[model samples]
Target: MAHKKLQRFQEIKTFPNVFEMPENMAQRWTKHFNNQHPLVLELACGKGEYTVGLARLYPENNYIGVDIKGNRIWRGALTALNEDLHNVAFLRTPIEQIQQYFFPNSVDAIWITFPDPQLRLSKAKKRLTHPRFLRLYQQILQPNGVVYLKTDSPNLYQFTKTVINLFGLELLQDYDNLYAATNLLPEHTIKTHYEQLDIAQSNRIHFLAFKLNQTLPIEKDVELKKLIEIHGTD
Candidate 1:
């Protein structure tokens, strides 16, 4: 297993569809994809399921899955190559440094699918929907761009709702139980490995779609933390 992982890590470096902590790519996605189509990102995209899936679904838009695990990325990158998914790519890097890879207003949309909930109060800042990451997302996302969060953790689902309410973000859609909804989109039905594992045991998928139309003030984070401290104990 160890040797195979090492081999995958080394092999991905050569895959034309994979970029590992590359430099000077902030404004070059269009050039790399050789088109002006909209660019969407799936952060922490383990195995690039959503990346390859979305690319297959929406051939017009480009998709890039961002994750730190080169070994895991090999699976999706190879699959995309085999299927000739020209619109799919994988970026091996931490989500925190996402801004470094794309220029301001370059990304059209972001999908946070079944990410780590960071349930601890102390680690709240690490949550993808936390203000810290939201600030980074705002830097790279277009003004009209939207963010989609799909998770099985009830805690994360509610936590994100609190952030949206407190930050005054526009909540475009919210479904506590996505599969239970009468109206469902094809993209929403794309399930990841984590989602299949049912690790949370919540027995339901939560989905939230919101726009960062309002500013998320740094001072507001203090209030956000306080709220988490109060209700987080449960």
Candidate 2:
């Protein structure tokens, strides 16, 4: 592994603000904070910009940044420690294993910020909005919990909208062009590293928020598959 990555692995081990597959994970988490504050998870939280940002915005809620990369997680973990953000924590784990940490209905909401669109049709199951992941999210999420997505990829934006429609989910908010509107919400203004480096240079940022329907059945969309097959995606 890279030197920085090795160092981060060693460093985060001691971070009071970070947790890595801890014992009694769920019980300890709620007790550590000594409150029943709503827990919000940021999946694929690269460097935890949205995690820390949201923690700062909503002090009443606890924030956990979940990502597999120790090196990337170190930045946000240390930031929370340095700033004394007691409610902010980073979880170094693969997004696929989220259910291992939190109990069902324990999480209040989820945020997926600038995640890989998994643009290719072959990678559809890997997309964060894919039915497989959504089902996993639903398992742990509170009833009617909302999933918020912020991305610069129009394909991912539309793909999520399609999933919502296909699954009969409740669409709470949909901003195709986030910056184009006047009165941008504070949470909407937070930018992730990927947003600056790859997506925002030319493309407009998009925000999608929807609630998971517990009874929604899973089915592949042939029309969506054809769309991905015909046109390339961002």
- Strongest candidate by lDDT: 1
Per-residue C-alpha lDDT of model 2 across residues 145-227, encoded as one tens digit per residue: 89999988888888888778766789998898899989778998998889998654546898999999746564455655665
Each candidate structure's count of clashing pairs: 0, 0
Against the reference, the lDDT scores of all candidates come to 0.93, 0.85
Q: Where does candidate 1 stray beyond 4 Å?
A: none
Model 1, residue 86: distance off in Å is 0.1
Every model: Cα RMSD to truth: 1.1, 2.0
